[model samples]
Target chain A: MRHLLTTQGLPRDEAIAILDVAEDMAAVGEREVKKLPTLRGKTVINLFFEDSTRTRISFEAAAKRLSADVINFAAKGSSVSKGENLKDTAQTLAAMGADAVVVRHWASGAPKTLADSGWIDAGIVNAGDGTHEHPTQALLDAFTIRRRLHGSASRGRDLDGVSVTIVGDIVHSRVARSNVWLLTTLGAKVTLVAPATLLPVNLSGWPVDVSFDLDHAIAQGPDVIMMLRVQGERMAAAFFPNAREYSKQWGLNDERMRALPASSMVMHPGPMNRGLEISAAAADSPQSTVLDQVRNGVSVRMSVLYHLLSGAVER
Target chain B: MSVRTVLQHADITRALTRISHEILESNRGSDDLVILGIPTRGVTLANRISAIIESVDSAVIPAGALDVTMYRDDLAQNPTRPTRPTDIPHGGIDGKTVVLVDDVLYSGRTIRAALDALGDLGRPRAVRLAVLVDRGHREFPIRADFVGKNLPSSMEERINVRLEEIDGVDEVTIG
Candidate 1:
C-alpha cells in the first residue's frame, strides 16, 4: 500500500483487490458528476520525466475524479529539463504538500528511488519507467481481461489456466515485461512471440513460454494475445531489417488476426503502428480492448490511488 | 455454511415500530425528514422504516432509493451489469436531513462511498447512517448513527438479512 512500483512483487490477493476496487472506481466515472470527494483535501502530483499523453492524462483524470487537487509537472518545460536533479524535484514536491505522486520517468527505477530515498513522504506510484515496468497499465489490462472473461466472477478467480501471448518489441516494451511477471504471478501461462533479436537475453529465468515463430505461438491458441508496439524511435538505429520485412514476419495482419481463437481477446498498449505491429482492422475489431484499456486505466489508477491514500488492504 | 436465524418476522416488525418512534422523538417531527435507501436491500428497509413512521405520526415521510454503486471505489474488480438508474424524490436533498438506510454494516466502505455519492445530488443539511446489523469490523473509520441491532460477529461470519419485500421472507441469519 505504500507504493505501487511494479506488479511483480504484489501478492495475488492484493493485486486482485486493487483490480476489484478499480471496478468500483470505474462506476464513479459513469456518474453524472463524474467525481467523488474521497480525497477532498489531498493533493496528487503527476510528475513526468518522459513525454506521454495517455498515462499522464489518465492519472490526472483519476486524481481529479477522486476530488484531489492535481498539479502536473512535465520535464519538457520544467526545471528538471534544465538539468535540475530528481532530488531537488522530490524535495520541491514534498515542500508543496503532495499526498501522492504519480511519476512516469525515462529511467528504469526512478519511482523506486523516489519512494525509498526519503526525499519525500508522499505515496509514489510508477506510471511507467523505461523497460522495467508499467504496473498500472498491466493492472488495467488485467482488469479489462477479468471483466471480459469473468465479469463479477473475478472475486475468486485468478488468471489461472489462462494462456497469454505477448507479441513484438519485447526488448523495449515495459508493457511486455510488466505483463510477463504479473500474468505469471496470477497463474496465467505467458508466451512471448517476437523475432530473436527483439527478444531479451536470459528470459529463461522468467516464467514464460518463449517462441520465435508467430505462427507457432498463434497456433497454440492463447486466451489473450497482447500485441506490443514496435518502437520505431528505438529502431532508427537498425534494430530490425526494415519496416516492410518486420511487418511481413512479426506484424499482426489479417491472416494472424483471423487465426486467433473466437474467445480470445486482442490487446495493444497504444499508440500503435497501424500497419507495422498490428493492422488497422485488428485494432478496431470487436475482440480489441485497446480503447477499453484506456477507459479502464482511469479506474485502475483510481483504485491504486485509493489504496495508497485510503490504506485499504485486503486481509 | 451453518446459518442461525437471529430475528423472526415479529421481531423485525417490532424493531421497525420502535425505530420509527425513536426517529420521530429525536427529530421532533417528520416534517423535514427524507428517507434514502442504499440500493438493493436498503430500499426495502427504508420503505418499512418510512411506513412505520407514517403510522406512528400523522405526516408522511418522503422516501426514495439512491444507487451508490456508480460511486464505489472498486467497480471493475467484479463484473457490473452496467450502472442502474437512481430514483430520487421530487424536492432533492437540499436543506433536508437525509437518513441513509442499509441492511448490514461491514467495513464502512459502502457508507463512505455513499457520502460522496450523495454530495452530487445536492447538499443536504445533515446526513445520518442507519444499519440493521452493525457487525463491527471497520476498515475505514466510519460508524452508523442509528442501529436496529448491534450483532457482534467475526469478520468470517456474514449477517444475511432477508426482507419480505425482496426475499419473500423477513428474517436475520448469521452464516
Candidate 2:
C-alpha cells in the first residue's frame, strides 16, 4: 500500500478498492469547484527520469486538486542530467518532506528500487517504468471501463464477466502488461492480439490468451477492444515491415471498427497513432473510451495518492 | 451476547416526520435550503427528509451526499475503505442553508469532517447537523440542530442504526 510499483501481483480487493475510490474522486471532479483539502499540508513530487508530459501533468493536476504542493522534477534539467542518480535526487526530495513521489523512469524497476531501497521515506507511485507496468494507466482504464459498464452505480463492482482484447505493440507496452495483470485480477478475461514480431517471447504462465490475428480476436466479441500505441520512437529495428502493413494487419481500421459489436468499447492510452494503430474514425467513434480514460487518469492517480498518504490501509 | 432494539420501524418514521416538521418550522418554508447527507445511512435519511419536506410544502428541496472519508481525522487509526461519492446538488451550495444529516452523532468527529468537506464546495449560508441518534460521548464541541432521539449511551456501548434503504431494515440497536 505504501508504494504502487506494479500491478503484477496486486490483490483483487486492493485493485477494486483503488477503482472504487477513483469513482469518488471522479464524482468530486463533477463539482463546480473541483478541489479538496485532503492533502493540505502534504507535498507530492513528480520525479520523472524520462520525459512524459502527459503523465507528469496528470499527476501534477491530481496533486494540485487535492490541495497538495507539487514539485515537478524533470530529469533533463535537474541534477539527474548532471549524472546524479535516483538515490541522491530522492534523498534530497525526502529531506524537503515530500509526502509522495510519482516517478516515471526509463529503467523498468526504478520505482520499485526507490521504494524498497529505503533511500526516501515518501510513498512511491509508479507513473510509468520501462515496459514493466503503468499501474495508474491500467487503473484508469479499469475505472473508465467500470464507469461505462455500470455508470454511476459502479462502486463495489468488479469486471467479473467482461472480456477485453488488447491489440498492438505488446512487446514494449507497459500499459498492455499492466492491463493484462490488473484486468485479470479484477476478473476480466484478457486476450492479447498482436503481430508475431510485436509480441513478447515468453508468454508462458501469463493469465491471458495470445492471438497473432486481430480479425480473429474481434470475431470473438470482446466487451473491450484496447488498442495500444505503436511506439515509433521505441522501434530501433522495424518490428513490422512498414506502417501501412502494420496498420493493415493489426490496426483497428474502419472495416475492423465496423465489425466490432456496438456494446464493445474502444480504448487507447493515448497520444494515439491515429491512422497507424487505430483509425481516426474509430478513435472518434462513440464506442471509444480513449478520452474517458484520459479524464479518469487524474481521478485514479488521486485515489492512489490518497490511499498512499491518507493514513489508511485497506478496508 | 445479543443486541436490544432501542427504536423500531414505526418509531424511526415518526421521528423523521417530527424532524421534518421541526426543519420546516425553523427554515420558514425551504427557500434556498439544501439537505446534504453524510454518506452510508445519512444520504438515505436526507432523501427521506427531502421527500417529506416536498410532500408537506410542495417545495422540491435539493438533496445531496457529502462523503467525509478523505477529511477524516482518525484515518490513521481506521482501515482504509473505498470512498463513497459526494454529490452536491445542482446550482451549488453557495448562500444556501445546508443541513447535514447522519445516522448517529457520536464523537462529532464525522460532523467536523463533514464541515471541512463542505468548506471546499463553495460557502454555504449556514450549515447545521441532524442525527437519528445522539449518543453523548462527544470528543468535539459539536451539536446537532435536529435530533430524532437523544439516547444517551456509555462509551463501551455501540449504536447501530439500520435503515430500510441501506440495510433492508429500519431500527436502532445498541450492543
Candidate 3:
C-alpha cells in the first residue's frame, strides 16, 4: 500500500480492496458535487518525465476530485532540459512538501527510484514507467471489466475465472504487461495474441497462453477481448512487414469483431489506431470499453492516491 | 474492563418498535419518508426499523445506506478506513424526509460527515437523526431526534452495539 509501482506482486485481497474503493470513487464522480474532502489540504504533484496527456490528465482529475492541491511538473521544458536529474527534481518537490507524487517516466524503474531514494517523503505512484508497468491503467481496465461483467455488485470481487484474450503489440505494451500480471493475479485465464515479431522474446515465465492467430483466439469467444495499440514509434526496427499486413494478420477488423460473442467486451487503452490496430466499427462498437477505461482511469487513480496517501505510509 | 449489557435483544426490539411508531407519528404515516443508515450496523438497524414501520403502518418506506468515509474529517488521525457503499433509494432523497439512522451517536463527527455526503447526492426536504443508542459525548452541537436509549457514559468507555444481521447477536454493551 506504500506505493503502487506495479500490479505484479499485489495481493488478491488488496487488488479487490482497490477495486472496491474505486467503486466508491466512481460513486463520488456521479454526485452533484463530484468532489470529496478526503485528501483536503494535501498536495499531489503530477511529475511527468514523458509526454502523456491522457494519463497526466487522469491523475490530475483524480487528485482534483479528491480536493488535493495539484502541481503539474512536466519534464520536457523545465529545469530537466537544463540537466536537472531526477534526484535533484525530487529534492525540489520534497522541499515543496508534496504529500504524494504521481510520476510517469520513460525509464522502467523511475517511480521505484523516486520511492526508494531518500530525496522525497511523498507517496510515489507509478503513473507509468516505460514498458515496465502502468498499474493504474491495468487497474482501470480491470475495474471496467468487472463493472461490465458484474454491474452494481462488483464490489470486493476479483475477475475470477473470466477469460481474456489480449491482442496486438505485446512487446511494447506496458498496458499488456500490466494486464498480464494483474489479470492473472485476479484469476482470469489470459491468452496473449500477437505476431511473433511484436511479442517479447520470453513468455515462458509469464502466466498466459501465447497464440499468434487473432481469428483463432476470437473463435474461442472469450469474455474480454482487449486490443492493444500498435506502438508505431517503437516499430522503427521493422517489427512487422507493414501496417496493412499487420492489420490483415492481427488487427481487430469488422469480420474479426463479428466473430466474437455478443457478451464479449472489446477494450482498448486509447488513443486507438482506428484502422491499424482496430477498425472504426470495432472501436465504436457497443462492445467497446475504450471510453469506460478512460472514465475509470480517474476513479482508479483516485483509489490509488487514497490508498497511498490516506495512511501516509513511511518511505 | 467491566462490560455491562445496556440493552438485550428483546429490549432492542421494543425500543426499535417504539422508534418506528414515533417516526410514523412524526412523519404522518410515511409519505415521502426515506430512511438512510450510516453504514455498518446502522444499515441493519435501518432495515429493522423500516420493516417494523412497514408491518405496523402497512406502507413501504424506502431504506438505504449512506457511507460518509470520503466526507470525514478524521483522515489525519485514522486514514486507512475502507469506504462502505452508499446506496440511496430508487426514488432518491430529494424533497423527502430523511431519517439518518446509526447504532451509536458519539462525537457527532460521523453525522456531520453524513450530512456533507447527503448534500452532494441530493437535497432532502428535511433531515433528522435517529440512533439505537445515544452515548452522549457530543463534540459537535448535534443531537439525535429519536433515540433508542440515552445511556450517559464517560469518554473513556467504549460502546458496542451488536446486531444479528452482522454480528450474530442483538445487544448493546458498554465497557
Candidate 4:
C-alpha cells in the first residue's frame, strides 16, 4: 500500500482492495460530479523521466479529479533535462510538500529507489519504470475487464476464473508483466504469448501459461486478448524476422479478430502500430475495451492516489 | 394497550427546530454548506434538516443522496439489491463543506465507504457526519459529531428510522 512499485509481491487481498476501491472510484466517475474530496488538500507530483502522454495525463487527471493539487514535473523541460540527479529533484519535490509522487522513468527500479530513499516523505506510485511494472495501468485494465464482463454490480469483485492471453512484446512490456502478476493475483489465468526472443528470459518461474503459437493460444478461448505494442526501438538487431512476418504469425488481423469468441475482449496498451501488433479492425473492433481502459485509467489512478494518501499509513 | 404520546409530533417538530438551531450555531450558519444524505431513509431526514436549516438561515444548501451499497466492504457477504446512483444537485463538490446526514450510525463502515465514494465526486473542504440516531455498535471506531437522539441499542435489535416524506411514518422503531 505504501509504494505500489511492483505487483509481483502484492498479496491477493491488497491487490483486490485496490481494484475494489477503483470500483468505488468508477461509481464516482459515473456521477454528475466526477471529483472526490478523498485526497483533498493533498499535493500529487508527476515525476516523469520518460515521455508518456497517457500515463502523465492520466495521473494529472486522476489527481485533479480527487481535488489533489497536481504538479506535472516533466523531465523534458525541467532541471532533469540538465542532468540534475533524481535524489535532488525528489528532495525538491519533497520540499514542495508533495503528498504523492507518480513516477514514470526510463530506468527500471527508479520508483523503488524513490520509495526507499528518505529524500521524499511522499507516497510513491510507479506509473511505469522502464520495463519493470506499470501497476496503475494493470489496475485500470483489470477495472475495465471487471466492468465489461461482470457489469456495474460486479464492481469490487475480482476476475476470478477468467482467462487472458497477452500477445506480443512480452520482453520489454511493463504492461504485460504487471498484468500477469495482478490478473493472477485476482484469480485469473494468464497466458503469455510471444516469439522466443520477444518472450522474457526467465518467465518459467512466473505463475502463468507461456505459449509460442498465437493461433493455439487463441484457440483456448481466452476471456481477454491483450495485444502489446511491438516497440521497434526495443527490438534488438533482430528479435523477430520483421514486422510483416510478426503480424502474420502473432499480430491480431481481421481474420483472427473475427474468429475470437463472442464473449472475448481485445485490448492494447496503445500507440498501436496499426498493422503491426494489431490490425485496425481488431483495435477498433466491437469487443475492444481499449478505449474504456483509457477512460478507467483516470478513476483507477484516482483510487490509487486516494488510497496512498488518505488510507491508513501504508507500510 | 399501547403507550403513546410520550414525545408528540409537535414535540418532535420543536426538537427538530432546536436541532436546526444547534446545527446552524455549530456550523456557523451554513455559509459553505452542502448536505449529503445517506440513502434509503437518510435522504428524507436530510431533506427535513435542509428545510429547517434553510428556513432559519435563508440559504439554500445543496443536498444529495449517496447509496453506499457499491462501496460497502460487506457487499459480497450481505445479499442486497444494487444501489442506485448518487444524485448531487450541483455540478460537483470541488470546495464545499459537506455535512453528511444519515438516519442512524452503527458500525462506521457505511460512512467510510461513503467517504470513499465522496472522494470520487469531488474534494470537499470538510466532511461532517450528522445522524438522527447514534446507536453505538461501532466496529470501525466511527462516530457522528451531531446527533438527534443518543439511543443505546443492543446487537440483536435493529433500528428502523422512518420519515414522513418517504415512508409516511415519523418514528423510530426497534425491531
Candidate 5:
C-alpha cells in the first residue's frame, strides 16, 4: 500500500480496493468540476529516467486534478544527464517536499530500488521499468475491462472466468507481464500469443497458456484480445521475417478482426503498430477499449496516488 | 466501553417524520427543495426523509450525496481518509434550497467543510443544515436548522448513527 512498485504480488482485496476507488475518481471526472482538493498543498514529482510522454502526462494530469503540485523531472536534460545517480536525484526531490514519485525507468527494478533504499521518504509509483512491470497500465486496463463488462456496477467484482489473449512482443512488453500477473490474480484465464522468438524462454513460471498461432487463439473466442505495440528500437536483431510477413501471420488484420466475436474487446497499450500488431480497422472498431484505457489511466493513477499519499494516515 | 441507546428505531422514524413536517412547513412546499446528505449514513437518512416528504405531500424531492472528504481542513493531520462519491441531484444546486443532512453534528468542522464543497458545486438560493443528532461541541460558528435530538455530551464521547438501509438497524448510540 505504501508504494505501488509492482502488481505481481498485490493482494485481491487491495487490488479490488484500488479499482473501487478508481470508480469513485471516475465519477468525479464525470462532474462539471473535475477537480478534488484531496492532496492540496502536497507535492508529486514525475521522475522519469525513461522517455514516456503518455505516462508522464497521465500522472501529471492525475496529480493536478487532485490539487497536488507537480514537477516533471525528465532525466534527459536534468542533472541525471550529468551522471547524477537516482539516490542523489531522489533525495534532492525529497528535500523539495515530494509526497509521491511516479517513475518510469530504463533499468528494471529501478522503482523498487528507489522505494526500498529509503534515500527518500516519498511514495514510489512505477510508471514502467525495463521489461519488468507497469502496474498502473495493468490497473487501467482492468478498469477499462470491468467498466465495459459491468458498467457502473463494477465495484467489488473481479474478472472471473474472463478469457484474455495478449498478442505480440511478450518478451519485451512490461504491459504484457503486468497484465499476466494482475489478470490471473483477478481470476481471468490468460493466453500469450506471439512468435517463438518474441516470447520468453522460461514460460513455465507464468500463470498463462502460451501459443505460437494467433489464428487458433482467435478461433477460441477470447473475451479480451490485447495487442501489444512492437518496439522496433528494442529489437536490435530480427525477431520475425518481415513486417508484412508478421502482419500476415500474427497481426490482427481485417480477416482476424472479423474472426473475433462481437462481445470480445480489443485493447492496445498505445503508440500502436497499426499494420504490424493490429490493423487500423480493428483499432478504430467500437470493440476497441484503447481510448477507454487512456481515459481510465488518469482515474487509475489518481486512485494509486490517493492510496499512497491520502490513504497513508488511515493505514 | 459502556454504550447507551439514545434513540431507538421507532424514535428515529418519529424524529425524521417530525423533521420532514418542519422542512415542509418552512419551505411551504417541496418545490425547489433538494436534500443533500453527507456520505456514509447521512445519505440514507436524506433518502428516508425525502420518501416521507413524498408520501405526505406527493412531491418528489431530489436527494443526493455530497462527499466533503476532499474539503476537510484536517487532511494534513490525517492524510489517509477514503473518499466517497459526491453525487449532486439532477438540475444542479443552483437557485435551489440545499438542506445538508448528516447523522451527527458535533465539532461543526464537517459542516464547515460541506459548506466549502457546496460552494464549489454551485450557488444555492439558500443552504440549510439538518442533522439526526446534534451533540454540542461547536468549533465553528455553525448550527443545524432542523435537529432530531439535542444530545449534550462530553468531547470524549462518540455518537454513532446506524440506519437500516446500511447497517440493518436504526438507532443512535453514544459510547
Candidate 6:
C-alpha cells in the first residue's frame, strides 16, 4: 500500500479499502465546497517523463482538492531531457520536500525503479509506465463499476460474480493489464478479446480468458465491456490489416453496442479514437461510463494519495 | 478493572424523552429545525429524538448523518479513518437551525471537526450541539448545549455508549 507501482499483486482488502475511501472522496466532490482539509501541508509532485495530459491533470486535481500543494514537473522542458538520470532528477525533487510523487514514464517499470531506488524519500504513484501498469486507472474503473452496480450501497463490497470483458489492443495497453489483474482479484471473471496480432504472446501470468473474436465476448452478455484505446503510435509494424477491418472486427460500434445487455456498462480509459476502437454512438451512449471514469479518476487518485502519504508510509 | 452501567435501558429511554421535549421547547416546536447526527451511534439517537419530537410536537423533522472524517485535524498523524454516509436531508440546512447530536462529548475535537464540516455544506441560521454523555476534559472551547448526563471521568477511563441498533443494548457504561 505504500507505493502503488503495479496492480499485479495488489491485495483485495487494500483495493476494496481504496475504493471505499474513493466513495468518500466522491461525496466530498458533491458538497457545496469541493475541498477537504485532509492532506493540508503536504506537497505533491507530478513528475511526468511521458506526456499524459489527462492523467497528470487528474492527479493534480486530486491533490489540490485535498488542500495539498501541487508542483508539476514535465521532463519535456526540464533537465531530464538533457541527459540527466532518474536518480538525479529524483534527488532534486526530494530536495524540494515532496511528500508524494506521481510518476509517468515511457519506460516500463520506471516507477518501480524510482520507488525502489530510495533516491526520493516519498510515496511513489505510478500514473502510467509504458505497458507495465496503470494502477489508478484500474482503480477508478473498478470504482465506477462498483458505483454503477451497487449505487449507494457500494461500501465493503467486491465485484464478486461480475463479468468484465475488456476488448482492444492487449499487448500495448497498461490499462488492460492492470484491469485484468485487479478485476480478477476483486472476484470478477475477466475475458480479454482482441485481434490475434494485437494480443500479446506471453500471457502466462495474465489471469484472463483470451478470445480472438470480439463478437463472441459481446454476445455473452457481460456485466461490463471495456474498450481500450488502440495505441497506433506504439505499433512499429503493421499489427492489424486496416482501421476499417479492425473496427469492423473488434470495435464497439452501434451494432456491437446493441448486442450488449440492457444493464451492461461500456467503459473506456480515454483520449479515445472514435470510429476506430469505439464508435461515437457507443462512447456517447447512456451506458458508457467514460465520463464517469474521468470524474471518478480524481476521487480514486485522492484515495490513493491519502493512503500513501497521509502520515508515515507503510510498506 | 471493572465496568459500571451508568444508564440502563429505562434510564436511556427516559433521558432521550426528556431531551426530545427540551429540544421542542427550546426550538419552539421544530419548525425550521434539522436534526443531523454525527455518524455511527449518533444517527440512531438523532432518529430516536426526531421520532420523539414528532410524537410530542406533531411535526416532521428531517434527520441525517454528518460525517467529519475529512475535516479531522488528526488525519495527518493517525491512520486513515473510513468515512460513513453523510446524508443531508432533502430540504437542506441553509437557514435552518441545525441540532448536531453525538453519543459522547469528550476532547471536544470531533465536534470541532463537525463544525468545520458543516461550514462547507451550507450556512445554517443557527447551530446547536447535543450529546448523550458529557465526559469532561475537552481539548477545544466547545460545550454541548443539551446533555443526557454529565459523567466527569478521567483520561484513562473510557465512556462506552451502546445503542440497541448496533450493539444490541441501550446503556452508557464506564470502564
Write one digit per residue (lDDT tens) for candidate 6, span B3-70: 89999999998988998888888988889999999999999999999999998888999999999987
The per-residue C-alpha lDDT of model 2 at residue A99 equals 85
Taking the tens digit of each residue's C-alpha lDDT, what string does model 1 give over B45-159? Answer: 9999998888878788988887776467664354432333355677878899998989899889889888877888788988888788789989898898788888999878978
Which residue pairs in candidate 3 collide?
Answer: none
Better of 4 and 5 by lDDT: 5
Tell me the DockQ of each model, to 2 decimals.
Answer: 0.12, 0.63, 0.64, 0.10, 0.53, 0.66
Chain B TM-score list for all models:
0.94, 0.98, 0.98, 0.89, 0.98, 0.98
lDDT of 5 by residue, B1-175 (tens): 6999999999999999999999999998999999999998989999999999999999889999999987888766774666777889889999999999999998999999999889878899999888999999899889999999999998898888888889999889998
Best of the two (2, 6) by TM-score: 6
Model 2, A91-132: lDDT tens digits are 999999988999999899999999988899888999889989
What is the TM-score of each predicted model, taking all chains together? 0.76, 0.94, 0.96, 0.72, 0.97, 0.98
Give me the iRMSD of candidate 4, please: 9.0
Q: Which candidate is the best by TM-score?
A: 6
- For model 4, residues A148-250, the per-residue Cα lDDT tens digits are 9878576457889999999989989999999999999899999989999888788777889889999888888899999999887765678878778999999
Question: Interface RMSD (Å) of model 5?
Answer: 2.6
- Backbone clashes under 3 angstroms, per model: 14, 0, 0, 8, 2, 0
Worst 10 residues of 6 chain A by lDDT: A306-315
DockQ-superior candidate, 1 or 6? 6
| Native contact fraction, candidates in order | 0.05, 0.75, 0.62, 0.07, 0.47, 0.68
Model 3 is docked with a DockQ of 0.64
**Can you write out model 6's per-residue Cα lDDT over A39-77, one digit (the tens) per residue?**
889999999998899999999999999999999999998
| Global lDDT of model 6 | 0.92
Top candidate (DockQ): 6
